[model samples]
Target: MHPATATPTHCPYCALQCGMNLAPGRGESPLAVEERADFPVNRGALCGKGRTAPALLSSRVRLTEPLIRSHATGRLEPATWEEALDTVAEGLDRNRRAHGADAVAVFGGGGLTNEKAYALGKFARVALGTSQIDYNGRFCMSSAAAAHQRAFGLDRGLPFPLADVPRTGCVILVGSNLAETMPPALRYLTELKENGGTLIVVDPRRTRTAEQADLHLAPRPGTDLALALGLLHLVVAEGRTDEEFIAGRTTGWPAARAAAMAHWPEHVERVTGIPVPKLREAVRMFCAPESAMVLTARGPEQQSKGTDTVGAWINLCLATGRAGRPLSGYGCLTGQGNGQGGREHGQKADQLPGYRKLTDPAARAHVAEVWGVDPDTLPGPGRSAYELLDALGTDTGPRALLLMGSNPVVSAPRAGHVEERLRALDFLAVADVVLSETAAMADVVLPVTQWAEETGTTTNLEGRVLLRRRALTPPPGVRSDLDVLHGLAARLGPGQGHPDLEKKFPTDPAEVFAELGRASAGGPADYAGIDYGRIAREDGVFWPCPTPGHPGTPRLFLDRFATEDGRARFVPVEHRAAGEEADAAYPLLLTTGRVVAQYQSGAQTRRVDELNAAAPGPFVEVHPRLAESLGAVEGQPLAVVSRRGRAVAPARITDTIRADTVFMPFHWPGEGRANTLTNPALDPVSRMPEFKVCAVRVETVDAAGRDTTPSTGAETADAAA
Candidate 1:
């Protein structure tokens, strides 16, 4: 039978933004994924996670009411929306009155819509007047964004569209496993190969994505910088360098060339463990093509020197005349749903709307004018994501935190410590669709609407802004995130001395978008010309659209770069050791990533039976040789210990990974949370933590029922439960 009328929209998972149709239909079949063949990004393709996303809307797993912790019983119980909002306002007010404005902190996420991110930032700066605000996107692509801005003077996840991927001559997939992370995107690589374009995958393990590459270089974890430098050296040595392009369109080539020349094939072979012959072959494969592109993801961007690491890769593109041309450039494979737009608006700590720097007086004045406040009243930039999380509840930190749409308990580096900081907070309020591990610890939990039940805009990895039209009505007692913010603003605004703050926080998504456009005008990520009508009509509008009649930009830097002189700048860099390295105490390197069946933090996906059955729990992937050396058998529990903490998970021995390295997926909580063993070493430029690599040790768990770690989603009882 043909389903009832449907709403054509995009998926709510990754940055690919795969288009799909949601059929609200009728009772017992309220949600369905139908065919949507028109959208260009994914061409109606959906992955397993997208196919199973409707399962998350079931009342059987999602929260349907507001919850407040009772003082007498000390347990979270159902409460009216008014009561929950009032309590949250009082908690935030009390904390602010006692300590200071900065005592009240706000934490946001990459999954939020453009309107919500903008409103959240305005709420922090205008309503509560606090500087302590940041989002999870900092962990996702800050390094790439930093590198992009430094080189091109602008930062978009991908400078060009995905449509160009199939036509490019060669693509160097750096540290991104698109085959497993976003299966629908892997088709781009497949199409590139079909077009006679060579594909090279660089990673520490032979992942499913690497299996499809013409050449796979499995370097030691944290040695991506050396690997990239070595390829550039070979390009120069082979006389493959585009001297004319470097001299005309780029600057700082001499210093960058000197840096690459210092790292010869033999020296890079010792650092990255890729052999001298493989380096020469990689250079030949990359330079032989008329046009090539370099793309990086979390693998190289989550290290201590992540910004410079990405910079090194961009140098290769500039040296070979690949950047700022047709079908060739440098891009970042953004991982989160709205990671590209999350920081582009105002959610990040150091940024204002339109990707403006908070430290810039002109930027502060522009955003402040839109906010209807004195520019001097605006607070300065605050701590980054990891730094903000580490400072909670301390004498030098905020006492109360309002966290929305993020679950740092499961996703943050050093999980146990972040949880401890959460517990130390005097007042904690969370707004989410489910009682996530982090939300379960909050004093008040506000149930919010999901993607299918909300109308908003999200900028995808291609810088295309797509509109997600609401298909189904939200369950009773639950409201959209905008409504939650509006209600809180009404109660907190007057007390914070703004009598009309509630008017600034609109419950309607379109109205919020209009205001966001004004705030984002004349900035890097200009959205002045784009509105709800334009976005809905155009399918998706690329950003920097300054006027209503102007067509959005699909490709950047084609004619000229976004710099002072329209020339890309190259910063000289050298390879350095990771924040930590495997020593005698920790003989193995541990790297963490995501699974195909689960999304970030596993908050909503873990509630789905199908996804859970597909990926029941987290486990450690060990090399066959390393497993045998540790006296571990397949499925045997093994305890992985680091300087911060210990986590135990069943072992799955495989030769896909390096013998000296092990792998874990960080989508779980408690004992199996790979983040528990991660280090919080911050990159000097990007402030991104070293989550991709850390030193660790493995030990066989005693089978005699001794102390053992609990599996994912099997945490101890909480007061709310």
Candidate 2:
């Protein structure tokens, strides 16, 4: 029953991880993308980025050689893999000998394959004996991760399967831009809206999703917690609470209810800048008692109070007893391809594999056994990403750092500070597929294979683990991230090599998937009995497939909660202001986000000529009234400055943005990185910086200056500060 020709497939661009088939065409490369129907997430839908992935994959800027920076002249020169690896090993060894294992920190990216992520964490803890490791997932979804673990005992990236969206009655989207970033997933929204289910959206900006909403609540930035609390108050006040569900399957009701009631409609209206009438309407439409769901994304979780904000959404779900029902519950909109899977497998600072906390002794023991190391040998949780960077700036911190697949200089919050720290490092080794801004300052740059050249597993937005197969081999001299780590670990010490490394870290992804399944057996995200053979037999299995004969779980919390008492407890949230606020001195609120033409930090999409031409350079979006007040016109250059730093970009006059605030995309830097003007203040709970809000003042570049419309043939020229 073999097919006539082998089909080439790869995960779609962006975080959805929707699979695609590539049938070779006339004059096309061996791995040309061809969208196919029947993929669970996409169902044949593709976005601008997904359809144009070929240009990105075959970009001319892709790095293919190992680069070594000369310590004396500060110049990067090409080197053989042996020289690069040897230099990196020597630097790491020297760091370990000087400041103990804790002094060496490792930073990972969410874009990496699961095998590479798992290897990075294990490599740091076992071979190098350093617990100072964390990933960029902290900035994207740590709040969601913390809340999901507390409520469901395990965080499913997408707890409910994507297919369940069409059958749902109502959807409450908070802080998610599915319409633009992930246009394919919006099919369910369109279907639900067409079928008469209310589509309520809450965000600071009236995004495309908000514009299509039956009700859109434009709350001030960082006031989401207040609105969520008020919504719960209304649900309880209107007697819409599901007492039967709560009584049968939940705990901690009294405290949660009292706390929610503390913020009434009028109280929250004043604090959140959402009108009382609109707040009442949103709650009334959402408390339908059946087929109601609440979803939160980076909007709520990217603030300084992200954890509390996420907790507010979770508490609202619990108070209304909307959880554990079909088409109902709290859903997190993850930002990376494998952000959920990365957090689940202990890539975060405070967590272990399986969403287990670092302080959990039993979980540590289990993971230690799986890693083939003594439980006591595993160091405690290390510093978070922000804290790690701050530490690097201090004299008594890590002098050497290993960065993989991340461009922190342009991506991190308060990037000016991060750039300073990067320059301060005595030794830095970067492993990536390209020479990113961060790589330009590294002591050693290891050219590593990208997603299309690697085979592994990545859990999608819905916590569905799928196989990511390689259809094309990497260019010569480029190695898989796993192989690079393996080589580095083997050279670390005389006897520090992984015993099962050969069997588990093979080039074939099936073996790695088997090892992951074995480690996950009987655990929270159990996939023990489902191996490559079983998965191939079926199309793709969802998590919790504990045994061979069992069907995968499509939805969670159906019968009972994962807690010991079979109950989901509610955690109350209080309103808090952003870390920075607008005042007379700093009159306008500055916010940052992604443009449809670019992705995060613009590391990949900017390389695509067409997409880059569409969103050429950094620009400040201002309402017409604000532009007039500042003596600015369309295409005019403007200076946006905050307490941290300043950046100059062209001004666009549009009513799409609020008059009191300015919007800018964080994709471009060296010219104008938004992080330069962003607040680095950490969220009290999640430690995520406030990329969403800061106080700033804008000024026109010239008294009679006007903006120039960039043509498709070129990008906007960078303005000299």
Candidate 3:
């Protein structure tokens, strides 16, 4: 590809996968982006993060050389790629010799391309012979994934294309601020309203997306489960359920229905803080529509009861005959760029390629055959993400870790503790394009190529697998992740008693993808028919494409669910409080989320001056009543203390949030790092941490050493300021 020639590709940010044309820079300059209007998902729409993604390619901020920490000086210095790779191998081998193969672990991220995710999983089991491997997607959408698997029999972020949202009669968007997190997607909601359809927004905060809703229900934090059950209760109370649909297309509805009936309108209002009239109105609008949908994001999914909470919402959709039909179903708005694809491949702890269960003998045989390895050699399911991170440095934990593309030091719940675990590791190797907070702690850091500097494939939120073309040459000393994996495999395989590195761990993306396709053949997330050529030719191909001549499946479960009986299963569920709740000691509920200007961990976005200016640092969004009670004023520093830790940020009092709760964005590190105060209580099924809700107490700090209440009222204070 010529430097000036433009190559069509997708954004490097969220899963919307908005298409863009990457115009290579002149001479040694970075790539420039232009809208590629041909892609259906976003058309020509792009968010600020998508537009400014190229800014990260600048050489000044990007890591161009491998770094190894010096033992004597305790500082990182530039080193040859050979030295870094050898050091990593030595450390991993030392740990394996002392402990066992399980003492060496691999941690992956949802941002990695499909090829990388596939290869990383293989490298862990084949080369390192370790069953301990998982990815950050566990924290992203595991709850929604678990719920979907239980309800619809398989998990795809959205069963139908986003294009169908506009045609739906009504949509209940639960726990997502699409306007800020995914700006391009907001247009679909706009179209939904323009088509005379109703939109009900559910959240604890009245976000930008909520402002546009026909009916915005501001519930208390950690009470989304009750709210969902309450809606289903209304459906049954009003005699609005589709008895035919439930009887024919579903099973176990008797138990699920009884569970919903337990959550009456009055009890639900008391739990969720949404008025009874509003709940009734929401039920009326949702059930009245001919076709309706329920979409959930991290809000309801990142909790101690997330899977069941999401199940409650799916039950509501199933009861109303809104699922498995045109423009009607339950879906999840996956956050990360490759979150959908990341979980589909073999990176997840409990899954093989094609979303096959690791514990299944048949699944192990199929994937092992594709990899030219014995089925018995393939390791069984490992620990979940939080569990793996938590066990690090302990007697039962992995002594060495290879982390790629994840900044858990800033992104994990109770991050202060995660950071402590990372520090306790005997050996830590990180591969990334930049020196992230997590990478800064690593013993050896390898510089890897960024988005436009590599060619690979990623599945978007719509299950559309699109190829991201290499538009520019990487800066000197930096290499692609595939190259890094290949180098490590070659060095580790012969010494670690694994098979030939060349055949088992190919560096070429196409070759790896071909092997992945074979491994995925006949599986739930089957991608046997999808190829690089087909994806480029068709713009993108939806998965479950099993054969060459077969067209990809854009919508799933239209004819039948993926379950053995071809019927959706309803899991009975009830509302429960968050893992940690408000009490006398900690009187306010604290929730965390994203800001429009920054992405997760802010490793790349924070380096971009434009985005940093938009959201310089975190601030507490406290309601006026809470601020008054705490004697805190706008722009004044306030300490939010929880049992785990304390995070101090400038106060921004607003009525958008509930008086009994406070909110913070979990993008930055340091004192403003919200995850520091978050609870790590995991959801039993999904293992998702309760990032959405925790108990905390707010204390005002005096500039003049006085603990007196603020003389000015919240009415005169500017929250946005």
- Tell me the whole-model lDDT of each prediction, alpha carbons only: 0.90, 0.76, 0.90
| TM-score of every model versus the real structure | 0.97, 0.93, 0.97
Looking at model 3, residue 36 earns an lDDT score of: 86
lDDT of 3: 0.90
Ranking by lDDT: 3, 1, 2
Better of 2 and 3 by TM-score: 3
Residue ranges of candidate 1 with Cα displaced over 4 Å: 1-4, 25-29, 704-721
lDDT of 1 by residue, 1-721 (tens): 2235888888989998889999864454478887788988888788888987888787888899999989999999999999999999999999999999999999999999999999999989888889999999999999999999999999999999999998999999999999888898899999999999999999999999999999999999999999999999889888999999998999999999999999999999988889898888888888898999999999999999999999999999999999999999999999999999999988899999999999999999999988889998888899899999999999989999999999999999998999999999999999999999999999999999988889999999999999998888888888988898888889988886777789988999999898889988999999999998998888999998988998999999999999999999998999999999876677678899998999999998898888999998999998776665566789988888899998988999998988778899999997899999999999998999999999887877787524443321111101001
Candidate 3: worst-modelled 10 consecutive residues by lDDT: 712-721
lDDT of candidate 2 vs native? 0.76
Cα misplacement distance, residue 566 of candidate 3 (Å): 0.6
List model 3 lDDT by residue over 536-567, tens digit each.
Answer: 99999999899988899899999999999999
